[model samples]
Target chain A: MLVIEDLHVKVGDREVLKGLNLEIKSGETFILFGPNGSGKTSLLMTLMGFSGYKVVKGKIIFKGKDITNLPVYERARMGIGMSFQRPPTIHGLKTRDLVQMCAKYAQNKEIDVLNLAKKVNFLDFLDRDINSGFSGGEIKRSELLQLMAQQPDLLLFDEPESGVDLENMALIGKIVKNLLRGNGESPRPDVPMKELKKIRQVSGLIITHTGYILDYVNADRGQVLMNGQLCCEGRPRDILEHISKFGYKECVRCLNK
Target chain B: MSEQIKIDRFKLEGMEVEQDLQQFVSKYKEELEMAGIVVNELERSGTYLHLNQNPLQCKSHQSGLEILDIKDALSKYDGLPDYYWKAVDKNKDEYTKLAASKVHGGYFIRVSKNVKIKDPVQSCLFIKDENVGQSVHNIVVVEEGAEVHIITGCATSHKVKSALHLGISEFFLKKGAKLTFTMVHNWGEQVEVRPRTVGILEQDAVFQSNYILLKPVKIVQSFPVVYLNGSGAVARFNSILVATPGSYINSGNKIVLNAPNTRGEIISRAITTGGEIIAPGVIEANNVPAKGHLECKGLILNDGVIHAIPELKGTRSGVELSHEAAVGKIAQEEIEYLMARGLDEDEATSTIVRGFMNVDIMGLPLKLKQAIDKIIAETEKDMF
Candidate 1:
């Protein structure tokens, strides 16, 4: 549901992404593997239309509309959502209030915020200040809770497994898979699996340094990003195996080839 | 810099008083409601209404609570031998001197020992005559092992402008007593306000003070101080201030911890759209094992100024004191974070400002809290 062509982004006098091209269709999940400072977050930020990540030469098409220069709120309203890695803490703004705000544009106007928060185990933090003194895993769950309320057509995740423990990782992985599959923990018991998968259409673009998320999500395709360029493409499991065996240094050979 | 108010421009006396409570409530209902006074409806333990230079109405519905005019209380108790002008000095400033020279009218509320008053005592100091100068001296005393709450509202009539209000308030809390005092100010655009206040707490006494100012005024300057004199006593101060165009507010709070095991905290939030605000706070700890903290924050929306000054002092080696102060505009990161949730810039900004001015921490009554929320919402509309 999103397309980028020859995207070149600059962040404060330094070019971070160069000649990047990618496309994801409806009902598809794309996994991006990258090293440090390899422009993974830059791509997600540019896609979401954040300020300070200037698009020097590029065009973005989302759902058949050019949104390269749209404001952040307009893009969000047009069904593009992002989960930040380190979100800012807003004092006196309760988590419940934010979730309600996110649900403002949803098709389902009446959303049960407390019930949605229960799925992510964030009921205790509903009345607390958003993202204040939250642990790493708690931040992830809070983000997921907000995304559930948003129900956007496209989701951009930035390292969902960065600071999660083993137990929390399993819970987060299952939720992420459900979000991408468009079922959200509720599947019809009468419909066949194939039929159910055909009725739901949601797209995801996930960035990960570690392939620990492969065990949960059915990622359709995977690609490697190194030095501001996409170098390799293959099955997510196969790409993980190749990188684990030889490290990201072997990606340069693929780039040269 | 702020505009100067000439004391000679206002009249000190000769204003008529409306002796009927129903007539007074019907005349200035909106203004009184804005100042958190619900006349003839709310279940208040006592009610006191003071017009310029006159005590129009004073009565107490609940037993064990006495509400009288300050002048009557003075003569009744032989100048209130233990309470009148005990905590606050009469010669501290020009406003205090004016209030001392001619005590127009104020409330004198006292709760009997070991009696817990359920409903709050409501009082209103109103000015309805043009160019009238009103001076008042208020005193509240909570006896030993007693509990009470007082809501004091000060306002000027809609048609009355160019008035000066000078107020002097003193509070005394005995051993193991609890007192919660809330004051709301809703003055006219040309009115100038000056209030001097001080409070003293005994052993195991708890005192909480909440002050709110949402309406526009020419100038407002006050710095209230409280002292913890006995061990295990606690004190807290919370203030929310907003200044519109042509308004100038200079206010703060100070707490002095004198006994061991005493604690104090001061927190203030201010916003200036096109006016000026100077917020200063201080806390001093003199005994060992005492602790105090002060926090002052301000936000400037348009072409205005906000100055925050926080100070802390410790006299002994084991005393702990700290302070934090910040004055600036809203951070862009906070705005963008909210924008990413699908709200436009204006909506997101107003939301953030609403949170910044949240009064939930004040623990006010539900009706008063709702009234203040409505006022904040109306004020936000003018900011944009």
Candidate 2:
């Protein structure tokens, strides 16, 4: 479980996330819908402990502990995984190798590198650098592989469906859904049953604009994030349908009232 | 004589190099030869020297490439250095540029245009004789559109008091050409190395140089210069100098972009445990549309010293020039990032350092690119 209590976050000189509050519980998926630069990514980065975002006020609690000052990897170690909207291209690190490294980190044991490559359908690309020269779809799939490998208790996705095309959209969705539904961050080496679940066990906080993900991923709740604050919360399908009809204008009315 | 007195001869006559340089080669043959560990033989294309070491593959000198043998390589530059071809050689008896010796220590190398060499040419410099000094000049000219990779390695184990290496290299990059140079030095604890290098670039040419070290040297000073005399020229210098115990690596690089749209990059990295490291470099971007950037990163693995001073002088307002120099211990957050992933502190340190160095070394020969990767990995290994 994770909680953001009235957090005020500043990215360098600008106060990006002004007095924001949100929560996500185990076995539930929370979706944060926002326009571009609506502080969605900033919130995600702050919660993930990226360096630049200074928490001027409020606290971020993950698994009942305050991690306001924790670094990104430390938070990642504490069962928190993130899918960057635009993942950086690391030229010499193979996508498959990075996935295996993440998996090994999660399992505390060697995860066969080739197996991870095949799992992401990247066996042919096992020699290519991480995200370097990758198609957008391949990058999205690669991120899904890392998320699955990490098997975090709380998975935060930033624009998961943004760049992927129809060719890889379904596969990415399926993998994302599986990661959300999986337990223990990694499949147990001996116990195969733990991976047999029809739905993922991960608690997720997803940020999106297109709402296309609502088709494959089940969202328990949807919140409107506008101008750095959560304006409203409701069921996923209802909130998505309203946005499709009028846009953030409906949220603006609620903000005015 | 019970004393250790060093002697150096600057410019010898048109003498036989193989015989004249015999004493210098014999002195440190054993030690310099040990610097090589085998690497993938499949990539033996560059100028390289590998010591036969077990466990770790000997330094992969050759990248499985078909080179015009040294006989052929030395044959092209048959007499005196080239100018706009006007020569002022001291002797006409010099048969070729390879035969020309106007300086203390010199070399002649030629790379044909559009020819992509597979392995790095190797140079193993070892100084074992205590009282004698070695002065050699080198001239390397890469013709238009030709490409080559070169690696020079040093090894010395004998506890000799004084020996010197005065090497000068002139690189001529013809139009649209490329040359990659890598040097790995591990001198004896008390030896002096003075090397001067300069490269002249023609239109649309590129030059990349990487100088990495892990030994505690006595006095290693080099002023490597790159003159961009043509349009759209590019140059990058990467150095990772680790000074252990009593050592001094005074390294510097100068880039002057005279032609329009030229660019240069200088990067100096050092890991000091003791002694002093002074990395002072400058980039002069005088022409419009030219760009130059200098970055220096230093890691004090323990105690000791380093002054990483990067200076940039951009006279042309249309030119873009920037310099950043950072000297500090390993970041705690970076360490914790590796530790959380289950690597020990040293492993994490090495991993981060290697990651910092893992910038794409792609254009190099397979062996050299692999050697760079392997040695970087080796540097991560714990050394007490």
Candidate 3:
């Protein structure tokens, strides 16, 4: 669903992502394990077309279109969605209004905002200003709520479990799993597993430092990013085990080799 | 005070409403509606309509409520010995002096003790003749344990381009009383407006004031002050202002907490396209266990100017006072955050601006709220 070739990104005077190449096929969930300052967020931001993350040399192909230089809103309209790690607090813009805006381009069925908000337990905050004085878990749920409304083909998440508590983590994890699996709310108990797997089309690219998301999402592949480069590629669970056992120092060595 | 107006340039009399009341209401309904006044009085508790120096209508439909012209009230109450010019000083400025010298016509509303009026009392001060100078004096008194709301709209007729409006208003809230006063202004492009206002609150009284001005004018300036005299009294002020090209507006509010357990807050939002705006707010706490806060926010869209000054003072050992002031363009981060939600830049910008000038907290009437929203939409076009 998304392809990046020789993506070299510069934030200010320093280059964050140097000659990076990655690709995720349709219905695939790719887990990225990276240390701090390893350019995980920079990559997500570059793909979303945020300003200040200048692309010195890159070509971002999304759904067969070259979107490397597209404006942020155009990219968002073209089925690219991102959940911000630290979103801005927009005073006076109600959360309910924003959710409705996200669902403005829905194709066929009408979106019931109240019902969607109930899934995220955010009904009480619908009239409040977006992201104003929200706790960490509330921010995550708010982001997930908007993403569900957008129903984008490709989803990008930056540390879904950073500030969430244990109880909220379980709730957020289940919602994220449902969103990535292309099943909203209920997964159709009558449909066979094989048929459901074949029909899934949503793609996800998640960045994680603690690997807590693995317990919820059945990711197909994983990679370790160290010093602006990706080196290790293997099963998602195996990579998590290796990193937890030896830390990122072993990944640095593997990159050098 | 820098640019002085020649008071002699405007005629003080002879701009009366000669038509029938019903005919006049139908003729100027559009302009009057823009200022938050409804011509139909079915849903209103009382209405006082003033045309230049003439008192066209003064009547009350609800019991325990009194509505009369200032002249009639003065004669009936012996010049309203306890209310007239009591809260506000008559010699404070040249505009006050003019209003005190020749009181054209204004409203005198009173709520009887322990009476709770549900519908708002509406007043309109309209100018319909060019080069006409209109002066008025308004007085409102809420008796002990009473509750009421007053909405005053000031506007100039569409054909009247150049005029002068000078208004003086005073409010008094007795013990355990509650009052909400909302004022909306829609003046002509060449009109000059000067208003002087003050309020006094007794023990356990609550007062809220909302002011909205969203049209162009030559020059307008006002600074209204409120005093919390007894313990447990509270006061709040909220204002929304906008200035278009060639317009100049200077306005603010001040509150003083003089008794223990009193609280005061002042909040204002201003936007300027090509005109100039000066907004200042002040809150002072003088007694123990008193608290006050002042906030002023301004947004300068294009080549315009906005100056926000917020101040707070605490004179007692246990008083708490604070202030927050910001003046600049809309933050780039806030704009991009909206863009990421699939809205284009223009849509995102207007949405942010609308939120910045939000009136949801004011609890305004539905019709008045819709009128303000329309004005905001029209103002956004000029901003872009």
Candidate 4:
């Protein structure tokens, strides 16, 4: 669903991502594990088309369309969605209004906004400004609520486990699991597993620092991004275990071979 | 009135608003209709009056509320109390002099002692004659233990290009009385408005004032003062102003705390697109055990310039006075944050502007708050 080839990105004068190559097919969930300052957020932001992250050399192909140079909103329209690490508080724009805006391009325009808000336990805050005075977990859940409303083809999450507590993490994990499946509704349990997977299949590139999200999201593959390059790929759990045991330096040492 | 006369008299002290008198009146009538200004007798429980440089019509249903023209009020009471008369005497300006010399239209409101007025008294004041100055001398007296709310709207039509509006308002609150005053102004691009307002609160009395201006005007300069003279008296001033292109707006308030334990707060929010706005505020604590706070926020939408100067003075060591003032463009991050939520750049900016102007003022009556909110929303929609 998304292709990033030979991507070289620069934030200001410093190069953050150099020659990064990545791709995610439809109905696939990819987990990116990285240490601090390892260019995990840069890739997500570049894909989301934030103006500050400039692409020097590379092509971002989304659904076979070149969107490397598109503005942020246009990228959003092209079905590319991102959950910011620190979303700024907008004073006048109500949360309900924002969710409605996200649903503008959805095939089902008449999405039940309050019900979506209720799933994230944000119904009371629907009338408030976006991210205004929200705690870290509240902000994350609010972002997730917008994504559910958007129902985008590709979802980019920046560090879903960081700063989230146990309770919030469980809720976020469940939501992320449903999001990957492309539906947030409770499974009838009577439905067959294959049919559910087909209904829930969505492409997602998620950044996890604690790897706590692995317990919730059934990620198909895992990749490690270190120093602006992809150095390893394997099962998400195995890659996470390898990093936990040896640290990212061991990956660099193995790459030297 | 066919000929335009550049009369040297009543030229206003600082700004100018004058065109042809007949044409101004005609244009004003059209604007009055649009503003829903009823000129005929308004007989209802709550008083609703219209003023066109004079008290054109007045209807009072409640026996406790006495609405009268300035002349009738003066003659009926034999004369106003020396305290309120002195309040008007304090403003020594050319416009005040013009208003005193030839008072055209103004209201006298008196709430009887211990009477609680539930329904608000509404008034509409408009200016029609360019050559004919529209000067009003208004007085509001709430007796001891009384409660009342007053809503006054001042406006001018499109064709009434130029005209001068000078308003001299004085309010008095007796012991244990409460008064809430709300004023809305919509003036033409060439209109010059100079309003002199003052309020005196007695012991344990409360006074709240709300002012909103959204339309364009050539010039508007106002600095109303309130004196918390009695112990435990409270005063609050809330204002929202939008100065459109080519307009010069200077608005502020000054509150003096005289009695121990008196409290005051002044909050002003201003938005300037391409106009020049100067928001100045002053709060002086003259006695120990008094507290006052001043906050001014200005939003410059385009190339407009805004100057926010807040001055706080404390006389006694036990008094506490503080102020905060800021002037800047809307944060780009805020705009982009909204845009990321699927709004275009313009929609995002407008939403932020609407939010910036949404400064919550406590104790607003639900009806008045809803009206103000609707007006603010409409203004935001029209602005962008």
Candidate 5:
């Protein structure tokens, strides 16, 4: 569903991602494990087409169309959605309004907003400003709530379980699982079950630091990104176990040989 | 036999142009409608097209809101009400004197004791004749333990170039009473407006004032004051203004805490595309155990200038007062954040601008709040 070929990225005169290549098939969930200062975020941002993340030399193909030069909003409309690791607090923009905007892009635009908010335990925060004064767990849930509302064909999650606590992690895990499986709740009762299932089962590229999300979604494969390079393609669990026992340096060392 | 008197003694230091009244009305019907005023009630002079046209067009009787023409109210009581000219002096400025000497048309609203008026009393002061000043004096009295909301819109037609509007508003809130007043203005590019307003809050009374000026005008100067005279009284002032190119706006507000345990807050948000804006405010804490906060923020959308001068004065030792002021462009990060959510660049910029203008209109009725939101949305469409 998504392809990245020799994607080179720069941030303020410094090349962050140097000739990185990755691909994920339709309905597949791919995991990316990288240490701090790696080019994981750079790849996600470049894919989303944020300004200043200059694509030095690369092309991102999604759904058989090249989108390396599209604006952020055009990319979003083309069924590409992302969850920021640290979403900024927006003053005077209600969380409910943002969620409604997301719903405008979803295939199932008639989702129950109140119920969706309740799924992330954010029923009372619907009227509050977006991410303003929110706890780390609340921020993650808010991002996930928007992503679920959008229901994009290709989802990009940056550090989904980074700052979330254990209690919220369970709920986040359950919701993320539902989102991937195409079973998100909808207010419309007229949609057929088959179509709903087809609409919900979306492909995603997830970035993780500690592999805590591995307990939730089934990953088809995982890759380690180090020093602006992708190496060591293997089972997500096995790669996570290796990195937990031995640091990223050991993984890089073993992969190079 | 009574004689019809025409007062023209007050004049500003500027020239006024001539315009056709009928053409002016036809050109500004949309603006008058946007302010939620009935088209039939609009008139060139102090006369209603329909005698039975209610000022509160939407369910006024059910909410127990009494709306009366200022002339009729004055005639019925044999004179102006006691609260008239009580908050704001009649001889404060040339504009106030102009309003008092020849008050063409205004509204008198009174909420009885312990009654809550759900619907806002809507009034519109529209100018259809050029070179003619529309001077009005309004008075509102909310009795003890009562609550009410008042919305007033003022505008002039684009055809009516170089007109003047002098408005004087006085409000009196008795003990334990609350009043929320919202005023919206949309003037032509060659009009000048000077409004003089003041409010007095009794013990435990609450007062809120919201002002929005979205359209361009030749010049506008206003400084509304509030006096927290009784213990535990509270006052809040919120304003949102946009200055188009070649327009000049000087808006300020003042609040005085005369009793202990009083609270006051002043917030002003201004956006200048190519005009000049001077936003100045002051808060005075005269008694012990008083608290006040002031915030002034301005956004320069183009090569315009904005001066935000907020002053805080505390005369007593037990009083706390602070102020924060800033003038700059809209944050690029906010724009990008919204753009990532599927809004285009223009949509994103306009969304952030709209958010900046929604400056915490607290304690407004739901209907009034919705109306204000609609006005903001419509005005922003013309702005960007």
Candidate 6:
């Protein structure tokens, strides 16, 4: 479960996230949509406990506990995971090392190195530095790998569909659905086997920018975040189609009203 | 403290095993062969690396590293090259040696005029002793228009008391010739290390070298000098060292550019955690068309540690020489961030330390750089 109550954020003198409030229960998939620099990343980074963003007023309750002031890594330790919009390319740390570290932190389990790599086509890059020279799609998939390894209770994804190709997008959607549906088994990727059958293990709060995820994923609810505030709530497709036709002009009109 | 400033140092009897030297040479040979370079029994030319007449040699478009060394290549040379020699010197002219174990510890390497070799020649100097002495005299000469790479690594295998290494390297880079020398020092605890090195660059020639010192020693006094004597000659010196816990390393590099359109760079990074490190490096360009730079960085990991006294002296303003020095410590925020991510304090510290020392040994051979990293890491664990 995830809850945000009257969140107020500011970068320098300008207020970004203005008293935003939202809630999502366990097993519920929610999509947050916003225009460029419309405080989308600011909201996500604040939730991730990033520095430089002052959470002036807000209460973020995850799993029935208030964690509005926890550190990024602390949040990550307590079953809260995030995939950065622009992930850091930490050199000298192999991809597998990072995944293992995440797994140990989130689940206290040592992930099978080879099995983890085979997921999302990163077997050849297991020993490579995390995103050191990865392509866009590769970076997204690697982030997905880390998320899978973390197996957190609440996962916040920042623009997962921005940098991936169509095939990778489909794969990410299928993986998320499978993981959420309780299919937490690494069914030897080479040969067909029984799909991981567990359901509703993770509740995902994802950010979709271009209606790309709507084409592949069916979310429970959709929220429009703008100018540091939640401007509207509607179906994911309805919000996507409105944004496509009006290009945030309708949001501006509603804000003025 | 003894009044002996240790202006002169050399081991009377070395403890290095013969097999160690053979292993280093063998590795060097394998890499050379893979590059299509043939290392025969010194041949009549007395040149260990025959880049010109050897035919595998070609003119490089730019100056950087090319290949890392393979293992066990020196054994193929048949008991070292005939021309390799080592000696100690006062300043650039006088020689002094109270004792020496191997009068000839390394093979002599030379390049002829207008003949250039692409692959670098590597030498390993392992100081194996406890309360003993060792000395080596390495002589290198670069004739006009010739090029070469010289890499040397020094370490001790056994615990030793009162050890010393007095080495003098005299290099003559002739007209338009080039030479790059990389030296990594892994001296042991309770050891005294003193090295005297110099390079003389002639017209249009360039001489560049890098020195990396790992772990800590009671006392270390080594400064390599480069003197530009010909028109358009160049020289560069890069040194990195770490000192912690009662260790004091007084080391730096110096370059004198006296020619027109000549260039040189001197960069050094030193980290002191518990002891003191005094580094005052200088780069002096004495005439027109000369350009040089000097940078010295020091990081302090713990309190009660002296990371002070890092200075850079740049002279000859019209010659385009700039020098700077800095001292810092690891931030608490950085540590806390990493620790929150499930890594313990020690693991995070080691990770940061290892990351800090990943010098871009780009032009150096990959295997050679990896070997150096491993040695540095090993020494770092001991220091901690």
Q: List, residue by residue over A1-257, the lDDT tens digit for candidate 5.
A: 89999999999999999998888988789999988888899888888898889998989999999998988988888888888877777667889988888777678788788988888899999989898999888998898889878888888889889889888888988888777776554435898866665655588889998888999888889999898999989999998998898879775795578
Q: Give the CA lDDT, 0 to 100, for residue B47 in model 4.
A: 44
Model 1 residue B39 distance off true place after TM-score fit, in angstroms: 2.5
Q: What tens digits encode model 2's per-residue C-alpha lDDT throughout B256-336?
A: 898998999998777777767889989998798988899988878667788888888888678899999889877765554
RMSD of 1: 1.6
Candidate 2 lands at a TM-score of 0.65
For candidate 4, write residues B1-384 as lDDT tens digits. Answer: 011223253343322345344454454654543343333314223543434454655567788888888777788777776534567664487667767776765888889999998867777777654534577888988999999888787887556678777889999999999998878788888777888998988899999988888778878889999999999999999988898888888888999899999999999989998888888899998987999999998888767878898999998899999888889988877777666656678877877887777645545555546555666776776565
Question: What lDDT does candidate 1 reach at residue A65?
Answer: 98
Separate DockQ for every predicted complex: 0.80, 0.12, 0.81, 0.60, 0.49, 0.16
* Candidate 1 positional error at A174, Å: 2.1
Off by over 4 Å in 5: A184-201, A252-257, B1-31, B38-84, B89-91, B97-102, B359-374
Supply the global lDDT for candidate 4: 0.80
Q: Rank the candidates by TM-score, best first.
A: 3, 1, 4, 5, 2, 6
Relative to the true structure, how large is the alpha-carbon lDDT of every model?
0.89, 0.68, 0.90, 0.80, 0.79, 0.65
Prediction-by-prediction clash tally: 0, 57, 0, 4, 2, 34
Worst 10 residues of 3 chain B by lDDT: B12-21
Question: lDDT of model 6 at residue A139?
Answer: 82
* Off by more than 4 A, model 3: A185-200
Residue-level error in angstroms, candidate 2, position B20: 16
Q: Write the residue-wise lDDT of candidate 1 on A1-257 in tens digits.
A: 89999999999999999989999999899999979999999999899888899999979999999999999999888888888899888887899999999989866657899998988889999999999999999999999888888888898999999899999999899888888877373577998777876765789999987888888898999999898899789898888898888898879988888
**Model 4's CAPRI class?**
medium
Worst 10 residues of 5 chain A by lDDT: A179-188
- Write down the TM-score of every candidate: 0.97, 0.65, 0.97, 0.89, 0.85, 0.64
Report how far residue B138 has shifted in candidate 6, in Å: 3.1
DockQ of 5: 0.49
